[model samples]
Each structure stands twice: as C-alpha cells, then as structure tokens.
Target: MWNLARVAWNLRQSRRLSFAIPPSISATQIDPSFFKRGLPFTTCKGFSTLETQESGGLIPSELLTKKTVLRPDRDIGQYADLVTRVTNFHGEDKGFMVLAGDVFDVPIRKDIIHRVVRWQLAKRQQGTHSTKTISEVSGTGRKPYRQKGTGRARHGTLRGPQFRHGAIMHGPKPRSHAIKLQKKVRRLGLKIALSARTAEGKLIVFEDLALPSHKTKNIVNYVTQMENTKKVLLVDGGPIDDKLKLATRNLHYVNVLPSIGLNVYSILLHDVLVMTQDAVNRIVERMHTPINR
Candidate 1:
C-alpha cells in the first residue's frame, strides 16, 4: 500500500512539470509584436517586421535632389587640378591651364582605356598558315614508289606534305582575343581616363553651341578661339544647337555630339572636348552620387 502511494505521488509531479512551460524560453517563440498593430513592421506597406528582422534593419533610401544648381563661376583651373591629382597624370604639374566655361571636364577611365586600346591592337593577326602532312592530304590511295629504292625520291600523292596548296597542319584557329577585366576595375579605369583628359585641357565646356543658322565658318572661328586647334569635339547637353551644327558641319576635325552619345572612343579620339556648364554639372552630379557606399 505504501509503495502504491509513492508511485501515485511521483506521477502527479511528472504531470505538473510537463504542463508548465519555462518563462525564459517563452520569449524566443512567437514575437510579442506580432499581436500589435500600427507599428512599422505591422503596417501594410509590403514590408513585414519579420522581413526587417531578417535583413538586419530598414534599408535606407537613396537621397537625390532635382534642383541641384551648378556654380557657373567655376574655376576651371582648380577643377583641372582635382582631376590631375586623381588620375596621377603630369598635366597639372606641367602647368596646363583649363579654361572655364567650356566643356573640357570629361570623366576618364585610364585602366579601361588602356585595356580597350590594347585589346584592339592585340586582335591584329600576322595571317600566317600551316602546312599539311602527307597522311592527311587526299589522293594517297596507293604509294607512288614502294617505300624502298626508287631512283627518284619516293614521291607520294600530288597532294602530299611536300606539294604546294596542301592542307595546313597545327595552324591557328579562330579564338577570342578579348582580355577579361572586372566590372568594377573597368569602371574605375574609365574614371581615371576621364580625369586625365580633364587635366590635359581636353574637355571643353560652353554655355551654348547652337546658332540661328548653319554657319560653318562662324562655328569654326568660335571653336578656333576656344580650342586654338581644328580638332575639337563639341558635346552639348540637350538638343543640337542649329547654329553650332551648321558651323562645324564642314570642318573635318570638328564633331558636334550630344551628351548622351558620349563614349570612351569618342572622348579619346578628339584633341579637345567642349561642353556646356550644364553638362559639367550633370557629370559632377553623376560622379558624386552615393554609389561608392
């Protein structure tokens, strides 16, 4: 009877322990905020509190201002100084002056430019072909002279290795001549190139490049004063200036292009680049964006 009583007491203790959940571990289960409303996590904005927790925090939005007015009274010389320092080119050290109010501020990617030019040059081939062996050539059904003594050299088929116009052996086949550069590195290279160009007085900026009519001579004269050279690339921010377009149309070395059409090839090909202040501002805005973060 005493043994039965003890077993019943132990059974009741085990039941009580099993029914009670520990307080310390309870907090780790369902979050208490799940029951709440109107919080940032519970709000119906497509994002859930659970997601926020998973991602480690709220993702900050990129801040952009539409009304970023550019400083017209810019020191082009100072701007060129910055570019020279960044690109590590000797243009600034050489005492090259950058004229303000021109489209001379161009972004460069030196590494990318170097790689691209090198790739282009490496693609050139010597155009040499190989010679084919006797076994691979056609018309070798029978031996000309039984491998042994034939007063004349034991000649095989006409299409043999010794004959002209035979198939080539161990020749170069079509393959990719491209060198792979990382995306980040390529972008940096372009920036460096632009910086170098800016330091070199290659980027030109203008208030406006268009005219009322197509006066090629007027455009040439204007560019000659600004660039002091016939070779110039006139880059505009918006629509083409009709007057500037007409003026440079006949000039062989002058090319008037839109800002959106700018490329590494076009930027590097010209002796000088002329741009409007607005274009420079746009470039600065683009470069200073919070992308580096």
Candidate 2:
C-alpha cells in the first residue's frame, strides 16, 4: 500500500510538468507572411501590386520602339526608309536613323562637287612649285659682253634669265591658286557624290556592328566574312570605337573611319562602302550644315 501511494504521487507530478512544457516546432517550417495582416500594395494596370514600377518610368513599348529599324528597298532603286527613333544602350534618346539614299542622293548639282574637289586638289598644290630667279642662280656675276658697244647683240651676266641654267623669266612660281566656290556649291557637291554612289549601288547599310575588345585581326576577319571583299572602308556612325579603329589600322587595304571623319574622298577611294545605320543618320545631319566651297 505504501509503494502504490508513492507511485501515484510521482505519476501525478510528471503529468503536471508535461502539461507546462511548450510544443516542439521548426523555425524553417514557419510561414514568412504570418506577421502581415493583408496585401501591402494595391493592384496596378495589368501588373501585380508588387510588380509595379516607379511613377514616370519609361513604358516597355517606348523602350522597344526607340531604335528605328531601316529596311532598305533594294528593288526600289536602292531607296532606304528613314527612321527617326532611337534609344541608347542606357535607354536614353539617341536620335533616329536617316536613310543614306535620301540624304546623299538628293538632286545635287554635279558641277559643284567636281569644282570643289578640283579646288581642294589645287589648294594642296600651293607653295609646292618654286622657280629660281636670276639673282638666285649659281653662275658668273660679271657681264659676258659690253652693253651695245660692239656690232653683236649686248650680252649680260651668265646667270641671266635668257640663258640655260639661268633664272626663269616670269615662269611658274609658288603661288596660291585657291579656287573659290560658293558655300551652296560645296554642299551640292557632297550631295552629288552621295547621289552618284546611291545610283551606282555602291552604298551599303549594315546592321549594328558590336565590336569586341581592341583586336584588328578579329575585326578584319568579321568584315571579310560579312562582305566577301578584300578592300573595304568601314564607317562607324557613332564615336570612334577604339577596338574597331585599332583592329583595322594595321590592315593594308581596310580603312575604318569615324562617321564624322568621312568625306567625299574617302568614300570614293574604297571599292565597297559599309556604313552602320547610325552612321547614315550622322551623315545626313552633317549635310544640313552650310559648307563653304
């Protein structure tokens, strides 16, 4: 009877202690949203409350339509579409694409371009030609004959302009022969050149040319693959990309020039013309400037 009473007392104490103990649970098993009363944000236009972007942010449509894709109509006599919408890599407005054909081939006077090119060449010849004067020639300073004393004709110093190895008499000398053409003429000439190229189907409009690190060989190879020609001049529409510049510098026949650096001469020098769409836009903007011929 004594042992039974002690056992009952111990069992009762154990039951009381078990009831006071807390339930066992894992921290990972707990629901993270248990602390929230309800959804914190309201719904937006077609997007969830949590997915709403900041106010005044650019729409996805604007971001996608920023760059204007130009589809050149080769069948339409090399005409290209002018796209005036573009965004930079940072999604900022970078301007639009103007078709090369429209800018370069706008009915420009051929004579103006020819005159400008001729004048440019002539200007380069200035100070190049030099003729020796009588005083500068190396020869005898003393008179060869007396002045009209004898029956023979009077003879002067050996270094006279009349004699061989003598100073030239009113001959061609170094002089400035700058040809003056009007500003309108110079502008027209550029337009004519552009027009001629477009008419001849020499102009090319390429998609974006994303360059890698500065590697000329790689660039040259890519260009060669793109256009199966050995002689090519690449015009970058934007700033001079160092990687593209350095890659083509060492190549003998390949010329890579920035769009701003391009002119009629360089464009005509190459057999093939490859311009990025961006470069085409830059060229058109440059034509709008009034140039003095």
Candidate 3:
C-alpha cells in the first residue's frame, strides 16, 4: 500500500526547496551540474525505517547560489536510517537489519561526546589525595628557640611550614571531582558515538556471542581476520557469556561489555565495535526510552 501522507509531505518539501531557488536564475536557468553533485534521498517519518533512495534529488540552494530568499517555516531536517548486515561467529551472512535513524545515524557532535567523556572520567576519579596541615601535624606546641637569642631565625613551632618535614600549606585535600551534566546530553553522546562508529564502518553486528568452549584461539583467529583492529569492543544485550568473557579476558586487545554497561567513553576507547543483534535492539530501545528528567 502507498503512503498518502508521505507523498503529501514529500510534495510540500519539494515545493519549499524549489521556491528556495534564486529569483534572478529562473527554473529554466538552473544548472544541470547541480544534479551530479547530490544524491537522491527520501525523508522518513520515524526512527525505525529502512534507508531509501528516491528519484528526486534534494539539492541545497546554496550549492547553486548562496543568495536566495529563505522561509523559517521550512523543516530542514534530513533523516536517513542505516542498514547493515548481521553475521554469526563464523562470519556467515545471517541477514540484513534496519537500525533506528535516531540512534545509529544521528548527526555527530564531537563537543557533546567530549563533555560526556570528561564527565565519566571525572566521576571515576578517586580524589583521595590529602596533605597534613599545621594543626593536623603531631608536634609539641612550643617555640623552636628563644627569640633573638641565637643567630637562627625565630620559629613558632617545629610543625611550621619553614621547618623540615613540616605540614604543607594550602595543599590538596580529598574531594569529589565529578561535575553535573544533563541526562539528555549523556544519552545523545551515546547515540552520537554509536553513529560515528557506524559511519566509519567500524561497527559490526553479530547474531550471537555464545561460544562452545573458552578457547582463546577461537577468538584470536576471528580477531586476526579483521583489518587494522588494534582494540576490539564486544557488546552483548544481556549479561556477558562466561565462555566469551574467559576467551577474551586473556586477550588484551579485546574487551567485552554488557549492553547496560555501554557508555560514550568505552565506545570511543576502542578501534572497532562488534555488537550482537540483541545488543543493537537494546541500544535502539534505550535511546528511544524516556528519562526521568
């Protein structure tokens, strides 16, 4: 069945884009070279649609000429879903899957990702460093020597900062280094990280991570087949499998994480991301889920 609403929306978008053309350059004067520079695409309604290419090419008016009348009422969002293949442990092609556009194909924002990473690292820091103050130091509350009697300079006590092994002044103390960050930013950072990996072709979806034995060689062989994978991140939807964990623990280049444990920092730390199909589903659901805030 054809979607009437989608067709109507597309007509409106096309009309708006056409009206954006420069007034001096009539529709007949539009350059043919513009079509070569852009690709045809269609806008979808939701996050969970398959990526589609349509006949009409949506070229920006700026590409033709910057000087043009603008309308604030036009929606400029161009969303496209990502489609990737799902393979098994043996690298067999299981099938293709459609990932949510909002989760796996969002526009990358490096600043948001950086802020979230800094937040995570700060929260993980153990601010336990401390220094003894003059009052906290153990020493007698007596003058070092008589004032002006000896050639040495007068001192209040042995625990003074001028004396050797004395307490430090204005030194570091134990405290929390964590900073406040919005929950929405953290969530968007995760999505952007995933989208970045996907756009770079470093993300692979596996059917399952379950293995027959805990042999390290099984994982080693599979990992060796990959290209330029200095470090690999394995994500599963549920609890990590025992065999998978044991097999990968010995390999320093490989790391396993549950879907619930996925964060922006961990995703950015590795070179390639290998996730199970279930993991992808869980991530998409989590991205769409609402937050308390």
Candidate 4:
C-alpha cells in the first residue's frame, strides 16, 4: 500500500515539473499578423528583420529611405528678364549683361530632340556602300545550259546568285542617307539644346575670342582656367577668328564653330559651351525669326 501511495506522489510531482517548463514554440505557433506588420517578436536564427521582409516579397524599409531628388524647372517668364554676365578672355568680368531669354526660355522636347539627332547623324553618313547587280557583273549574258537536258538544275546566267564571284542579291547600294526635318523643328531643337545647357549651368558667355597671338598656348591656358572640363565648343557670330581657330585646332577636345554652324548635335556633344556675346545675340535672333515653310 505504501509503495502505491509513493508512486502516486511521484507521478504528481512529475506532472507539476512538466507544467513548470515552458512549451517550445514551433513554426505553426507563430501569429500570421506578425508577418503582416513586417516584423515578428521571434525570428529564426541567422536571419535579420530586413532579410525577413525581403523574403516576404517586400522591399526593405531602409532601402526606400533615400530617394533621388530632382531640381525644379525654372519659370519661363523669368527667362525673359534673365541677363547673363559676360567674361573676357582673361576670365575677368566684363561687367556687361546679355539678354538670354529667347534662347533659355524654350521647353525641352525629348521627342523632337531625338528626331533631330537621328536626322543629323543620318545626314552625316556617306552612304558610299555599293554592290553590283546582275547587269553590272562581268559574266556573259548567255545561259549556262539548255532549258532541261541533264538532271542538274537550270540556271539563266553565271551572274545568278548561286555562282561564286557573282553579283550580290538585295545588297546595299550607294545612295544618300540624308534625312530632312522642317526648318521650325530644327530651330526648336536648337533652342531646346541651348536651354538645356543654360539650365544645367554649362553655358559661358565671353566678350570675344579675339586673341593677341595665334599661339595655341594662349587659348589653351585661357580655356583651362575658365572651363571645368576639357570638352568645350566655341561659337562665334561671324567667321571664326584666324588666331582662335589655329589656337583651338590642335586641341581635340576644343572645337570652334561659327554661329551658323551651331547645331543640336555639336551643342549636346560638348560638356561646356563658350560663346561670344555676338554669337548669343545671333542665336536669339535666329530663333525669333519665322520659318518660311
């Protein structure tokens, strides 16, 4: 009887001990709401909260904290009254202002720009590629064999596509790849290019490109001091000065073009645009003129 009583007491103590120990949490015991909040009180070992969020098909909150900020576009009306300061060849302030409204007020048109660039690139192509046709080939016009005699396939001439050294079939021929765009469209594209440069603060206006000597070192030293980058395009109102041309010719990154030569392609290609005040006036006037057709 005593043994039975002791066994009952032992069993009760074992039951108490089992209840005192906490139950281990299994994967199924986790609340689904914790996942919806993107965090859980208990996480698996060797994993982080961010990793948990990522594994749940959600972007990590920390990654989305930093964002790309863009500058606000300048007002069109403000450009009309805009006056840019002019600097001299020696980088000294000339204390003169040039009206930049007409050139800087234009809104950027990406589609028109793309079309103009494509057109300019197309016009530059020489299109000199040539291929001879059957008529141009050296082979005689006579047929290779009779209509149908042997088991071999019939051929009209040796110049046909099958024969070696024969004329090419549907090959490229010499022709112009030039593409024409409307004058107004071209003008607008130029304005937009200028405006883009202005907005980006890459346009520089100078009194003139006139230099004392034709030495390359003079212009190179001047440009190196004034420009932040080596890629610069100089625009002059009239014919480029002989000294300036010679000075800039040796430098691959520097280009000199008359105002008339100013196009979207050259403008966009350069990192900096340095133009004379007269050149700026010419561009504004050109943009103001109405296209004939």
Candidate 5:
C-alpha cells in the first residue's frame, strides 16, 4: 500500500511542473549570443525571445549592433571644422572660413538624394494635362446606323472608342504626383548633397558676393577668373541684392539664390556651390534648429 501511494504522488508532481511552464519556452533553446550583445533578456509570459524560437535558429548577424554605427556623426568629439579658402568676386583669397562639420561632413546616400529630388520635381509640376471624355467630346449623339440591319459593324456615337478623333478612354487626368516624405528625410537629403559637394572638393566660399556694378561684362570677367567654371551657384545670407541679381540674370549658366531658397535639387544641378560667410552661418543655424513633431 505505501509503495503505491508514493508512485501516485510522484506522478502528480511531474504534471504540476509541466503545466507551470508555457509552451513558448517549454522546448526553446536560447541563443547564446543574445546575452553577449547586451540585449535585454526576458522570459515573462506573452514575451517572445525570437521569431524562430521553436527551432532555435541563431540570431541574425545584423542584430549584433546598432544600425547608425557606421555614420560619421556618431561621436561628439569628432565634429572637425571644414576649413576652406574664402575668396572675393575677383577670385583673390581673402581669408579662411570654418564650416560646420555636422552639415558638410554627412555621409552621402544616393537613395535619399534621389527621393528628395523626385519629390521636389513632382511638387513643382503644373499638372495641367487633361483629355476630353465621350460625353464632353464635340460630336453628334445620333447612332451612325441601325444595330443589326447593316452588314458592317454597328456603331454608336461618332465619339466612340473605335472611331477616329474619338474620346480617350481611361486617360491621365490632372492630379498631384507629390509623395509624402518626412521632414527629417528632406533635411537629411539637403545635408547629404552639401556633404557630397564637399567630398568632391567643389565647395567654394566667398567673402562677399557684392558686385561693383550690374554690368553683365563685369560679371563675366569675375567668373572667368575662377578657372572658367561652367556652372556656378551663388548664395547669399538674405534677400539677394538687386545689383547681383540683375548682373547674373543673363548668364544661363550662373544662378543666384538667397540662403532660404537653397534646396537639394539646386545644389546638385550646379558644378560648384559659392556661398558668403554670412550665408554659411545662417545655414548652420538653420540646420541646428530643433524640429517639432
């Protein structure tokens, strides 16, 4: 009798222990590397260790570290100044200028640049394209012939799909093609473009873009001094001066814009970016401003 009771008690204890553990961890073997990476470890109810916990597959190699580890701006002490020569309109070196590393040293990303350029182009489109439909077409509504009497194919209105000069079917209409992109993404794209120019050694800083006169000939002389650059973009801190704008108006290869008007598309269009000292300060301040959600 004593032996039989002892056996029954052992069986009940085993069942209780089995029911205590949930199915998720009952047979799961934890990945050893999970703890090495400093990831949080949890085994509470409703919490899962991994997607393939049942089979105990090793953690993906990508999950070993943070994704932003490769970016150059990861360290606070690494924000080195980008020193470049500041020249006057006559192409004479005036002094040296220090540019913010955060803005001009960003890593280049082609996908983001492409996306922002596309977004800017799409937003600026006129969206005026249109086509007339069957009801709107100018034509007689009467059928061409009876439905079954003629041996030729029966016809409806002259503006039908099969007839010449007919209305277009399911054609494109006037609409917006602008896609929604995050403000952070737009800002980042601009930074990347600037960085790319810097990386290519094409960034030029000017002490001042103030032209002595609005004569196109004088501007041409100044441009020729800069190694005969083909495309030039001149940027000022605030509203462009009347003299400068008028002087460059005739030069199709030269464009002038205020710092506020700067954009990624414009930056990439030109071979060189010329900016005043004041413009660089304004740009750096603008980039550092906090963005609100």
Candidate 6:
C-alpha cells in the first residue's frame, strides 16, 4: 500500500512539471517585437534580426516615384562676369575689360542639350544607302521548270531569294535623316550650352577678331596667349574675316564659325569658346527675341 502511494505522488509531480515548461518555438515563428524587447528566451540557431535589417534599410515609397528635374535652379546665381581682352596678331594684350552680366544666367537644361545634339548629328548623316530589290534586279523573268511534268519542285524567276545573287530583302534605301526641332527648344539649348561654358570659366570674350595678314603663325601666336585653351572654336558676329578663315583652316585643333552657325553641337564639341564682343551682343539679342508662337 505504501509503495502505491509513493508512485501516485511521483506521477503528480511529473504532470505538474510538464505543464510548467512551455514548448520551444522556432526563431522564425517568434514575433519580431519579442526580440526587440529583452526577452529571456533562446532563439533558433543561425537566425538574426540584425542581419535582415543590415541587408537593406527601409526605403520610402515616395522616393522611388520622385522624378528629377532637368533644369533645377534653386540656388543658382543670376549674373556672371565676362572676362574680356583685346590682343593683336602678335598676342600682345592691347586692353583688358570686364563685362558684367553679358552671358545669360539660366539653369542648365541637359535634356534640351541632348535633343539638340541628336538633331544636329542626325542632320549631318548623308543617308545615301541603297539596295536593289527583286523587281529591280537584272535577272531574266523566264520560269526555270514546268509545273506538272518535272519531278523537281516548280521554280519562278532567278531573282527569287532562294537563288544565287538574289536581290536584297528589306534593304536600306536613300532618305533624309534630318530631325526638325522647335525654334524655342533650339534657342534654349544654345543658351544652356553657353551658360554651361560660362559657369565652367571656359568662355573668353575678345574686343574683336581680325588679322592683318593670312599667316597661320600670327593666329597661332595670338591663340597661344590664351591660358588653358586646348581646342578653340572662334565665332564672329558678321561674316567671318577672310584672313581669319585662311589662318585657322590648317589648324587641326581650331574651328571658325559665324555667329549664326553657333549651335549646341559646335559649342560643346570644343574645349574653349572664343567669341568677339560683336558675336556676344548678337547672340544675346537673338536669344532675347520673342518667338511668334
């Protein structure tokens, strides 16, 4: 009887112990907040909250939908100084002057610049590619085989794609690749390009560009006086001086263009832009002109 009583007591103790201890939970199954709080519980091995958070930080949804403005001028200044100088054919400095607020101080428009460049490049393409089609080929129109008598498959003209020396299929033809752009867009592009050059301190203004003689050495000597100039694109307001043209023609690094020929492509192509006072005035006037529509 005593031995039966001891076994019953031991059974009750075992049941109480089973109810006191809770079942083990996996780290993944535990609530994330539980780990944030100092809970005295062991998590499953190889699971970490720090690892997941460190992999990628929380990104706001609004940031993903935000668009970048091509011409953002929140803190850009309104006016800039124009460095001006007059030099003779011998590169001697005749006079120095500072023109204030000469170049336009507008925000840079990268998109407009890109479009203008693409349009200019497109217009330059000759697009003279040509190919002969089946109809234009010089093959005879006679049929090669009979319809019913021959065991071989029936054949048509020799100009067919299956035959040798066949006409090109869907080949290119001559056409113009010029892209028409709006006048306002082109104007804006030029302004942005000029502004960009001025902002980078690459714009140089001259009182005038004239040469006494057509000697290339004289022009080279004059250009060598300009500091930090690698490749030069010289622009004049009116007709290009004949002497200047002849002097710059042989120069591989120097290009001469009239004020009317100043475009975004040519402006951005060269490292340094050398413009005469007349050219700058004409450009500013052209840019200020209101479009009809």
Query: Number of clashing residue pairs in every model?
Result: 33, 3, 0, 0, 0, 0
Q: Which stretches of candidate 1 lie over 4 Å from their true place?
A: 1-113, 119-149, 152-157, 227-230, 238-250, 257-261, 277-293
The pairs that clash in candidate 3 are: none
Cα deviation in Å at residue 275, candidate 6?
Answer: 0.6
State the TM-score for model 1.
0.45
Could you give candidate 4's per-residue lDDT for residues 68-163 as a string of tens digits? 333345554245646677987787889766566767767778998999999999999999999998899996899888889787888889987789
Residue 16 local lDDT, model 1: 71
Q: What TM-score would candidate 6 get against the native?
A: 0.67
Q: Which residue segments of model 5 deviate by more than 4 Å?
A: 1-79
lDDT by residue (tens digit), candidate 1, 1-293: 99999999999987775454343433345454544533333323442333333323222111111233233354332344332211111112222233322223434445567875565455554445444465666665665667677667776556654667665666565565566555545444445545556666565445555465675666655655653564777777777766766677778898977766565566677777766655555654554555552
lDDT tens readout by residue for model 2, 1-293: 99999999999997775554324533344445533534333333443232114322322232222333333444332335434344321234555555655565465455666687887776667576788888789877897878875897777688877678888888778778887767666666666666666655566666555665677667655555544465777777877776767767788887878788776666667776767777876778887766643
Clash count for candidate 2 is: 3
Query: What are the candidates' C-alpha RMSDs?
Result: 20.7, 31.4, 13.7, 16.1, 14.3, 17.5
TM-score of each: 0.45, 0.57, 0.73, 0.73, 0.70, 0.67
Query: What would the per-residue lDDT of candidate 6 be over residues 204-292, giving only the tens digit for each residue?
Result: 77777877889999878867877777888999999998999899999988999989989999888898888887888888888777898
Per-residue lDDT tens digits of candidate 5, residues 48-79?
A: 34333322445543223322222233432234
Q: lDDT per prediction?
A: 0.53, 0.62, 0.82, 0.78, 0.80, 0.74
**Residue 238 CA displacement from its true place in model 1, Å:** 6.0
Pairs that collide, model 5: none
Better of 1 and 3 by TM-score: 3
